[model samples]
Structure formats: structure tokens, C-alpha cells
Target: MTAPVAHAPVPLQLKRGGGDAFIVEHSEEFVTLASTAPSPPGSTVEATHQGDAGPTTVRVKVRGCRRDPLPDGREGFRIDGRFVSLTRADRAALFGSQSEADPGSTSET
Candidate 1:
């Protein structure tokens, strides 16, 4: 089996104005979010990750969502999504500077 992806929980806010959400894990291609409500799969949503550079917003396509237990013992939704679009600056802000081109997209021409 593959090792689990290690990630620190980071607070995230849905641009559409939802209750609240947090990123439980993330990678260049996908993110798993813990949300108060279920986000339907195939839906596109925007979320911003506050990094040292500033708030980096990314558009994501919801792949799946399932019920999960929250830290407070309340029911929460575990939302999985794939990155739909990300700019070079957004990649640098969210994952730090990359000497080479980002995966799935190249840096500025």
C-alpha cells in the first residue's frame, strides 16, 4: 500500500460563501477538505489558502464527498477535489517556489 499523504489542517473558505471548511490534506493535483456540508461531486468550487505570500485562490472540481467525524464529535463531510486551474503565482504561493515548471501547466511563457 502507498503511504498516506501528510498534511497540516489549514482553514479554508469557500468563495461561494458556505458555512466554513478546512483543508485536511493537499497536493499539486488534489485536496481533501473537511466541511460542515457535503459538496456535490462534479461541482466546481473556489477555495483560498492563506499562505505567507497572501491568500491563494484555486478552482477545484469536486470528485467525491463522504461523511466523516469532526474533531468536535460532530458529523462533517470529507470533500475530495481535483485542481481545475492554478496559475504560476498561485502555485508558488501555495507550495513555495519551484525552480522548474509546475505539473500539468508550465510557468509563464
Candidate 2:
């Protein structure tokens, strides 16, 4: 008789959303948008990059949901939110400064 094989678990990558775009993370659900945001407990909120197209107002809506286990066996929270009419300054603060040549490029440094 052949022995059963065990498969390795996959890792999760948290991505930052752009203007009007928000990220959502959950045990089994993950999504991204340009107008909505996520409000998970202990989750840090920030603005998007400058010159990006989005809303001015940002809204985060969090629900009482459990997050999936990380590769390191750490627990996380599930959240969601929204952003309205975000300006260049707002984007710069939230994300980062936009590139001089590429309007869409965001400088993390």
C-alpha cells in the first residue's frame, strides 16, 4: 500500500490598494476595489498614492470576522472599507509621492 502525501500550505500576500481602491481580507475571501476599504480590528489605515484617480472621502467598514492563519501560524483580522474623491495630496500621504515622469508611479522612498 502507498502512503498518503501531505501538501504544504500556501502563504498570503497583503497588497496595498490605490485611490478609490480598498483591500479586503478574510479566512476564505480576498478582494480589492478602487472605491471601498477594509476596517479590520487593529488594522492600520492610510491614504493612497498621489495623482491617482479615486474618491476624496475614505470609509472603512469592519465586521466581526476571523482572518485566515498566516504562514507563520499567526492570527489576523478580516476588514473592509471605502474611499471617495481622493486628491493628489491625499494620495501622496496615503500611498506615497508620485513619480515626476510617470504620474502613476509611487515612490516608497
Number of backbone-clashing residue pairs for each candidate, in the order shown = 0, 26
User: lDDT tens digits, residues 27-97, model 1?
Assistant: 66777878777779999877777788778887778999889965455788888987777887886776556
Model 2: lowest-lDDT 10 consecutive positions: 25-34
Model 2 gets an lDDT of 0.35
* Error in Å for residue 32 of model 2: 6.1
RMSD of 2: 14.7
Each prediction's whole-model lDDT (CA): 0.72, 0.35
Q: Which digits, one per residue and each the tens of the lDDT, describe model 2 over residues 1-109?
A: 2222122321222235632333322111222222233345435345432224443333333323344433344454433433334446653443445464247656566
Query: TM-score of every model?
Result: 0.69, 0.28
Top model number, TM-score:
1
